[model samples]
Target: MSKKNLQARDISWLSFNARVLQEANDPTVPLKQRIRFLGIHSNNLDEFFRVRVATLRRMIELGGKKGNMHLEDNPQAILDQIQMTVLQQQNEFNRIWEDILKQLNKEKVYLTNEQNLNKEQQEFVKNFFDESVRANIIPLLIESLPQLPYLRDKSIYLGVVMRKTASAYDQKYSLIEIPSKVVGRFVQLPSPPGEHHIILLEDVIRFNLPYIFSYFGYDHFDAHIFKVTKDAEIDIDNDVSTSFVQKIEKGLKNRRKGKPVRFLYDKEMDAGLLEYLIRRLNLSRRDNIIPGGRIHNFRHFMDFPDVFKAQKKERVPFTHPDLQKAQRVTEVILQKDVMLHLPYHSFGSVIDLLREAAMDPDVTTIKITAYRLAPASRVINALINAARNGKEVVVMLELRARFDEENNLEWKEVLEEEGVKVLIGVANLKVHAKLCVIKKKQGTRIIQYGFVSTGNLNEKTARVYADHCLLTSNRSVMADINRIFKYLENPKTTIQHLRNCNTLLVCPNAMRKRLIAMIDREIKTAKTKKTAKIYIKLNSLSDELLINKLYEAATAGVELNIIVRSIFCPKTDQRRFKQPIHAVSIIDEYLEHARVLIFHNGGKEKMYISSADWMVRNLDHRIEAAVPILQPAIQKELKDIINIQLADNVKARWLDDELSNNYVISGDEKKIRSQIETYQYLYQKTGKHSEASSH
Candidate 1:
């Protein structure tokens, strides 16, 4: 088999999601965490449709079979495949839900519907609905409307069927969106004796169906949960007059009414009602009609209330010993290059550095890039404070960061109000680089101190995302970073000064060429029969050009290993490449999001920590940076961590040429989980508390 006969990237992504479903079904997983895994799987599918599937659908509509040769079939056929896989997964998901419900009941937690609720629970749900949900209900009569109402994307709705006793055939259909945003989907019901009880808001409405329509004189009522997932790809109009911010805001509103890409309905829904919905909503079989469980929007499980005892939740993770051992972050960074690995490491070190910069008298300017930030971002607050403290603060805020547009917009307004100069990203490119540079004056010398990360500056995510932040004062790299910021400040300015940047790889300029050259160097060394290898860790690897180059290198006998968390599109089947290219994915408790590349340049190894992935969007359409690891100690540390992940057989799954995610099985050997073991390694190195207690 050749590399040309690989599965489509979208299909490969669905396979990855199937692995997530596998986690949900794995009995070894804790009960509550399995429910959370279901949520993650659902959320990932939603985005898969919003971006990848939606893009393919448009391509098929515009160019027919001639457009997308990467796909062996039409968009309709691909969607059919997706729907079939989703339906199967939905069945598995339903079974998992049933098992979880049984487990919850064993733990004295009962999830009851209107039909199963006891008298006390029924009374409590009815009263609670009247107080919290009734006021928010907005019913739409389907028969009287000139056109069907536009349904919000990814929101649950109750498809209500109202029957009249006078005529058996005259049944009026209505739609009422469960006001989950205003009132939560789950409502706690009064416990009976020693058992805890909860009911969904849909059930609460189901119990009061007669009261909702008593004035209309209808008694026969049935409601089934359904949801529509529309295309969330924002289409910014090419209007020169509209500012970028205005365009983004308009695009966001337009995204609400974007083309419907998917429609998920309850499996037990009436056939007639399903047909009615498909007709009214102008949906076709190609629109991915998935038959799901009774409930939709399980993504909200991320916030599932811990009403049960605290013991039911996973234990709190200890802060990373490296960051915790630092007496003062800036002082420690100045003394030695400190590498902070997130989730294991507290993001507090970054926050503490910002706070120090905000108050330091010698600090003259603070420049940073914001891609995705938390709602209550301490990073933003620190920058705002620095601006107020008479220091120059510039924030390159990317407003087009997918689902984070609104939060970024809110922070943009707040930062501007506090006199911070905000740059709304480059024209057609997103500034996805996680960089912060603080300029301070010390005895007539201007010193630069900052860190670049592979993940967002959001502290909330930092607690659950495995990322790396490099705090450095390297002169050449700092000078290159300064020039990059200058170009961002004025894109029209010529970047002649950046031509000398050998320490950093700036994307859309030299990253691709530099990376290819590095690979070629490995190939040359391998041809000469010297030990040559390449190890890469990234979020995605889908760029055809890069993959082809990697294939060429592998054919040249360069050993290659990759740890890709999602979306891998390379086939390593040919005897030329053989088993030399090994790819694995690790889906652990924390999101593996760091981008690290290590190259064996003969005997002298070169390592780089990058903000860019091996994807075209990150290389050609984003302002990204990849800085070299000049510090020998930090280099060895990163190498050791990657080695640990490579040895992981517990959470790692091999990505084969068939794209069949097969778990890397360890037969009778000691199991190694990279995340847990990495923490242990760092704990040992930093000489903080005993590892046994931390685990």
Candidate 2:
């Protein structure tokens, strides 16, 4: 594919979010999940603005220096496209929300604003506000201030125009940050029997605006919700005197004062208040000044009340067949490698492995890499237990894990206090690899066993994120993991350890080079007219060099099947190609997050599960790893799952050149939804009677 034909990464990302919006619009999807999909789309877009949009704005500021970055389109052009795409998505979002509201009302569930509340709800809102919200609110009188008060990112603020009923001229512009973080976004109100009435936290505040600002004696108030998404880039200074942790702490503090990249407000907001906000926030039209509906932070909708009568039939995860019979998880992993397909299989086994290692008399050391973790992480708890049990526990926690920076920083202190040696990772490189290594002294001979995964060690996300984890005691893989930890221990001095990794493909050293070589091999095989095929699954694929190589392979008649969930940049269509690339994106209840690569090497397939996407940052900037699927059975299992995804007619969108996001329709074939089918396939293999698949 020509570079000119390649989709811009940000544009492709928007298309991916559009797929999410499709899920929300899909009537077949459960109403609850459809609402959740809206939340997911909103959350994804917020991050896109915070990071991708923020980066483009920076590149535009850099001017000619952006050429060094090898961008496909001008930064300003991409920003303009992004703004247009976001506006369109927002319109679609509003339509879907309105439709959902109708459906909700049909189910006798009402979402009412302050103005639409009944007398009973008005009393409840007042009581709820006085008891729950009164202490948390800090109403700002913006007109009295010399400059506008600092508006926090990821928070929604109610822009108020308070004036006496008789005199519209005597008005005060005020801002009230919704205390949603403390009091939640959704407030349940009393309703008629068997009916549910829900109100937004902002609406609850709006209903009590009279009491909140009664001292000023304002008889009328015009309040509308607005949100500001700031540039989340942490500018880590070159202050050698400060520790890495201190730099992160300082960077996080500075991030609060970041430039506002996007200012989203209700279109019905008071005109004067909107103008005041834009001028005071120093945001121009180019800065994504978007006019949205009444709702600003739909992210809070992810936790929308479960008031619907149709409850989601939760699919309980079963123990992996290989682990079910084992006395201890360590025993099974040490004997044979076991691949745990998350959400379908229990994550408790992983914690069990760590806990067993902690209590085992022979165990001596435990090492793991953490990128993002759960709020109440069982993995962290296990590691902490091991530390208290006198085992040497080293956690290479990445403090720069985007929004999880503060949480990880707090974890760092807790780990250190518990005697666990916490390594904050190397300078200028985030450890994105998910790996663990435990050593047990077996009669003077050290035995190593642990896990390698394609996702974070977050138990909570494990339930919702489709990922793969390999529990293994393979000597070479364990050695490579240890080598990676050594580099993290002393990055400047122990760089050789990272370079020496053999079994696992280590990024920023050999992964990219080796991946290109693998693609070249496939091209050579295709030229010979022999069977040459590659199947890849990733959350994203935007690396230019790798994309170019794939294009060359396609031109050489090599068969390629790609299942990318987001940010796919490669154009599957090319006139010179001997065959078209089969590419699709899956969006469903579970997050399709695993990264897998398969190479049909002369009938001997080479398979790997990786933590990295094919993005330039994952390959060239962050520390990542991909472990080979050594066991034939495990490789076949992974291949089966990939095949299931490839055969999906439902929830799979054809990734065409136009980025139309058309659903993959299977004419006269079974309607296979990949996530549900994969779960059934794995569950059946457990030799237990399978339950019906649920969304």
Candidate 3:
């Protein structure tokens, strides 16, 4: 498909997020999960505005000097379309939230705000505010201040309109930062047996507004929530004098002063106060000034209280069958390759491998790459332990992992303090690949083994993110991993080492070309009237060249199966193709995060699990890896899982030409939910059965 015909990636992403909203509106979904879906949608939109929308604004500012950036349409036009879509989604979001509120009320659970509090609840809120919230709040009397204080991004503020009881015209405007970060956003209130009352932290402060400004003798108070989303793009200056770490720190500090791209508020906010606040923030009508329901930051609702009457039965991850009998994860992986389908297979094994390497006397070195890690990362702890155990531990931590920059900077210090060598990755390129290799001496011969994963080394996200990690002792794979690390260690001198990777496809050097070449081979086969097929699964698929190649293959009669979770751009239903590509997107309880590519290569099947998606940044800019799945059993397992997803009828949606996320039709076929089916597929391999498997 041509650039004009292909879907705009940003617009397609909004469609993907709409799928998230669909989940929130899905009555079949558990109530708690539905609420969490709302949170996910809100959080997703926040990042979209901060990054994607912010970039478009920059393009508009650049005017005629749009540079070499390939935009599908005019920036202003896209922004207008984005505004229209977002406003529509906001209405749908409000409706879903209202329905959820009614559901909560039916369960005798109340999300009571300041106005709806009963006598006992009012007294309870007053006491709670005085004891817990009073100290954290600092009300800004904006009418008197020379300039407004910096409005923090990702934080909600209560715009207060205070007036004398007797004088209707005399009023003062003030702002109070909701201390949601320090004191959490949700507070559980005391209630009678079999009933629950919950209050937002902002409401607690709202109830005591009179007490907060009592010295001024304010009698009437109206407080509504508003949030500002700032441009999150970090601009690192080129200064030979400043170190990379210093540059990163400076960039982070500058991010706080970024221009506002979005201003969202409760629609019922005081009209005058809203106008004053917007004017002071310098946001114009052209900006994403959105009005919504009472709740502004629904992202916090992801952790809504566990007070539902019907409890969800949590699925416990089980050990991989190959590792079930082995005393050590290291030993099993050393014997044969094992692929871990996360959330189905326990992540503890990945952690255990590092822990074992840390304590093993034969182990001499451990090298790993980290992009985003858990808050309390056991992987980091294990590396630190290895360092303390006299093993050389090298960690290539990407300091520019988008929103995790500050956290990674703090981690760099902790790791360096523990004697672990920390590498902040190559300049202008993020080390997006998840790779690790451990060297151990066995009778004067070195044995290397580790893993390459499609997800972050985060224990917290592992329970929900669907990902793949392959633990192997394969010599070629390990050698390629080591070469990539060598390139990372000294990119200026070791660029050839990255270029020489043979077994694995390394990006910025080979993956994109290799992928295109593979597509050409399939096309050739299809033209010769052979059975040619390609299967792909990725979080995104928007790179132009690859899409064009896939279009070519489709024209040559190549059978394609595409399972993309988000941000798809290809026109799958073009008229010239022999058959339309079988494309589906699955959004369910678990996040579909793994990247897999399969080619029929004239019936000699080839498979790979990758850390990179088919996006321009991932293919040509970032350092990435895609390792071949050589083990037959593991390849079959991966194929089976992909097939299960392709056959899904419950949660899967068709990615048609219109970008309409319609549910996949089951017709006469039996029902299949991929995540649940995947669990059963793996669990049955262990020669065991459970209620969860049947779920």
Candidate 4:
């Protein structure tokens, strides 16, 4: 387990995804949730192909994986490993789907197709198709046209082969785009009172293929599902002649027509049609052509109909005690720091803080950074309202957030139109720091308070993404925030401002150095036989320098704990090390998205909630922030959450050398599902606080 022999980034990601597949395969999970896990795995793999695999392919195409020092593995080797891993996972996925369907049958639920429908159900489906789907779908004759229609990425299509009954040579091929986004994917049909019947949108189209091509008078038809995943990495060149916004706009268009990274189709699809598609698309074996089940896009299954009976009590998110009945979120923050743990804590306080600033006449300025936003975002609405109220509102909205670029661009337009000063931020370094600072005037005194979060301020994701947002009026923190924003506004002239920040770790050139210094201290303390421990929770930890530092600390006998959600590259189980590190990953109902690091400084404990993971890109190429937890109460609360996760035996999986993804078995011990227990732990506190406030 030398640091030099670290896991390949792509291979590590595939292992992470294998954990997700394990969730889908677990029989202990609720049936609906299991199905959703399948969808999540599918969606995750699609993105993996589009980004990571796509990048590897490009590297291979540009000669060999030689000059690129960033690549952890040879491109060809990683690509081959990916294909093997993905095919194995796909087999498991199909098996899980079959098992789930059987379970659904036990519940008197049936997923019907064109051939299986009865008279009434058939009529219902046909009517539903005519009324809703037909208008939305456009069938393209594939071979008849000189060139194929540009297939929309992530959308499923019904690859059709129509033949005249008398002549096999007179067959035609066409593609019908499934109108799932507009019409819907799963359509319910008339059935017996005790039984439920659902038909896929593609099957409905398949039933009416003859009618769709009535002009051609085709009698026989064979249709199957297929989808294309194109390279999603947008290339923004350093061309001074074009504006940054213009460059992004151009990149977006090019992204749409990006070289195909993967083409997945039903295994039952006709050999002729599949070959035709491969030829037209000019796909090589490197393109990752995969044959899967009838369903090409299970992601829509995430929105599966709620027809099944409830199997477990649904958990509810309670309001945080600090902001429960507060008159003003700003007022509370001014008095003391308030840490809001997301999903377990309602995100209303964030909106309230902004809304209060928007309406408060004394509020003079508001500054925030946005990476991803929810549709019809209350955050944006508050910002726009704040701008309208004559406050100096500034937003550093990163329009380069992948998959969110289009929406962010639209958000940029609205914010600019509403008179909000928008900064796109320094190119090559995406502004990813989740920060907000609001300044108010009170009788010639200026005061500032806002929140710093580990996740996006997106209201939608806030309901499911586990994160921490600290609302505070710490003067030093406010000073550092302003300094970072100043640097962002004028990076060329004022990069030194960020370097001077005393309270916050600003990334690109600062955080990495600080973290390394901290790790060095831990190693020194461990060598002296004094107590030393480092606990970290991050989305990923792939930076070579940091991983090697952790290894050095591990060899020095410093206790280490790491909970990474994805792309972990370190070798934690080396026998040469003095101690085995505790590393686990939890994939439960709530996404574990927070990044916290704790360093036991001999006796004095230091903890920080960061906007950056240990990934090289975040540390060296992105604007990130990490703020110290000065409040003892907030620090202890974070420690409690981390300890709970560490003790979790139910959902946590060992990040061992084998990547076997074995559950931390709770044999003869009390079972602890950290997500549920954490919710209860925080929620019960709300009642106690309410009683105290009333008294």
Top lDDT prediction, candidate number: 3
**TM-score of each model, paired residue for residue:** 0.95, 0.98, 0.99, 0.97
Residue 135, candidate 3: C-alpha displacement in angstroms: 1.3
lDDT per residue for candidate 3 within 286-370, as digits (tens), equals 9999998888889999999999975545678999999999999998888999999998999999999999999999999999999
What total of clashing residue pairs does each candidate reach? 0, 0, 0, 0
Ranking by lDDT: 3, 2, 4, 1
Candidate 2 residue-wise lDDT at 434: 95
- Of the two candidates 1 and 3, the one with more favorable TM-score, higher being better, is 3
lDDT for every model? 0.83, 0.91, 0.93, 0.88
In candidate 3, list every pair of residues with a backbone clash. Answer: none
As for candidate 4, its clashing pairs are: none
lDDT for model 1, please: 0.83
Candidate achieving higher lDDT, 3 or 4? 3
Write the residue-wise lDDT of candidate 2 on 1-695 in tens digits.
45586888989999999999999999998898899999999999999999889888888777767543545458888888888889999999999999999999999999988988888888889999999999999999998899888889989999999999888689998899998888899998889998998999999999899999999989999999999999999999889999888999999999999999999999999898999999999888888999988887887788899887755566778899988888999988888999999988998999899889989989999999998999999999999999999999999999999999999999999999999999897776789999999999998699999999998999999999999999999999999999999899988886889899999999889999999989999999999999999999999999989999999999999999999999999989889889999999999989999999999988899999999999988998889999999998888899999999999999999999999999999898988998888888888888987765466
Prediction 2 TM-score vs. true: 0.98
Model 3 misplaced stretches (Cα beyond 4 Å): 64-72, 310-312, 693-695
Q: Which pairs of residues have clashing backbones in candidate 1?
A: none
Q: List, residue by residue over 1-695, the lDDT tens digit for candidate 1.
A: 34455556777788888888877777777667778888999899888888877887887776655532344346666767777777777887889889888888897988788999878877887788789989999888887889889898868889988888888887888899999889987777778677778888888998988889888887798799998888887888889999999999999999998888889898888778899999988998768888877888898876666666554323234554545656667777666677787776678878899999999999999999999887788998899889999999999999999988988899899999999999998777888888888899989789898988899999998888889989877777778888878888987666554455667898888999999999999989888888889999998898878898888888888889899998888887677773458889998778899999999998789999999998878888888999899888889989999999999988899988776778998899998988778877876665654434212
Off by over 4 Å in 4: 1-4, 64-69, 688-695
Among all windows of 10 consecutive residues in model 1, the one with the lowest summed lDDT is: 311-320
